[model samples]
Target: MEILSFVAAIAVGFVILSWSADRLIEVASTLASRLGMSILTIGMTIVAFGTSAPELLVSSVAALDGSAGIAIGNALGSNIINIGLVLALCGVIYPLVVSRRIITRELPLLGLVVAFSLALMLDGDLSQTDGFILAGALVAYCYYLARHSGGDSEDDEEVVILSISTARAVVESLVLLALLMGSSKLLVWGASELARSFGISEVIIGLTVIAFGTSLPEMAAALASARKGLFDLVMATVIGSNIFNLLGVLAFPGILSGGLKIDSLVIQRDGLAMAGLTAALAIIVVSSLSMGNTDKASGSTLSLRRAACSYIPRYKSAILLACFAGYMTILGISALA
Candidate 1:
């Protein structure tokens, strides 16, 4: 009965967290627009951070509760899910056009950030100094995005123009933010209890259940965008969210706990897996870009139709899906062992 209650609490917590995050993004975006920020700026900065709020809150709460495993697991696991699961599914549904900006700019930046994270964790813990470093990187990244808004004019025009008074927007944003934080605390507590009851490491629970729960919003958004044929948006969303998860979400736990101990399995398994996946994504994008250009130079009429078609073949998606499935299977076996 106790175990069941914890499971229920986790479920309810996830629901409330997801809802509050969505509302928070809406209110915050509206507020940003009213403050003279462009919609592209709002999308790149506010929306990106808003989507990652759940992970940030959950990891911070776990750190404060002294569950270093949960905090570290949530950060690394979410990055794995964002790329291995979420992005792969998006590709399967709609082969994403490898945007130059993503290949040349965002993907490399993600690689560098992940490398930096690995370097920090090499000493077996994420200290307060590491947290400050990551936090500073996040600020620089956000500032760069703000200064260079890449979204099309249509995206800018699609910004929700809220008629609410500035005072109301601020109040609503605060209320939703509070609710998000409270629900995240509830989630951490329940997830920890559930892990204890199951005789499983909190890291496993955090890597699988809690990671998936917090990633629900990203999955939903990716699916929705794919259906609309907005493949570029889907790619941007996943890449940007992963960056925030690594830098922003991971930093919070370090700051809250002063330092979080590294789980050996996390370093040997999850951390290496994340780096590999990020590298694979970069290779794919770069190769696709080169292929597209080569095909164009060769005067292939098919390549002239849509440049993306030359690069993202249907079989590539199948390969990505298979890789994700295999990774999940490994995790399941490890958990059982």
Candidate 2:
């Protein structure tokens, strides 16, 4: 049946995107380690930025194709999903204790970017000036991280050397990058085609279907990190990646938009959704931090038992399903309105 074929194509796209993202992360992590970058820097810069490649590719291509709604919707919707759907589930899976480092440094930066994004959207469009400001902010944020994150000291003997040779790392990074690009292309194309075939608007496709397709990497990474007991890393990936999505991925296409214009509905609906999600994430993080500090100050210790017991039984898949449902509802209302 045509339905079965469509489902099969979506399944294949998911597999390709998830697999490519894993390889890309692996290659990028190894490359950063080999180049003597701090793990924090690697996480914040390379891993965070690398995982956002899908968004970058999607938005850039959509902008070029004059599908500004697709470009903007994908970025805005993914920002919501990344924080709400990804980080919330990350916390639910394992109570993520917010590190002081993240709270003092990255959290503020994330908030700043979100504020900047909202200010731009209030003008009823993303002007070239807005794009320039965002891109400039991204550059400054990256520079701040590089300077304050402090590259690993030359004297730290505990730093592990990468097993892969430089040549191999280079080859792997390039190959994975190519594969990611190809898969993204296929995903964007198939998504548009499927939307047209189903008589769905491109905005709906971008908000629900395309956003999830592009978020395959974050889903895989979060699940993998959860399994490894690296809950903080999972949170970091989601939070940091969302920040990059707003500033880095959105800015590039916005700059190239000449003068971005769209329906106020984008800001009215998706913008509020994105803000609500980010706020939920902040509450979760802040709650966890408070709980963690109380325990630490009272000379209590944390264990897997406490974390596992404290989880409120929300899985990543559940969050994802709920997000999908919510997105569908939003689309339904938008289409009808």
Candidate 2 regions exceeding 4 Å error are 1-8, 23-38, 151-162, 290-328
| lDDT value, candidate 2, whole model | 0.66
Total backbone collisions for each predicted model = 0, 0
> For residues 143-180, what per-residue lDDT tens digits would candidate 1 score against the true structure?
88867664432233435556788799889876765665
CA lDDT for candidate 1: 0.71
Looking at model 1, residue 145 earns an lDDT score of 84
TM-score for candidate 1, please give it. Answer: 0.77
TM-score of each: 0.77, 0.80
lDDT for each residue of candidate 2 in 1-337, tens digit (9 for 90 to 100): 7656666666776677678666555555566567666444655666567667888888878887889888888888778767756666665565444455565567767777787788788878887777888889888888887786554322122233457887898787667656655665566566666777867777777786678667666766665555544444465677678888888778888888775786688888888777766665554455444433233322455543233212222453355447646866767877666
lDDT of each: 0.71, 0.66
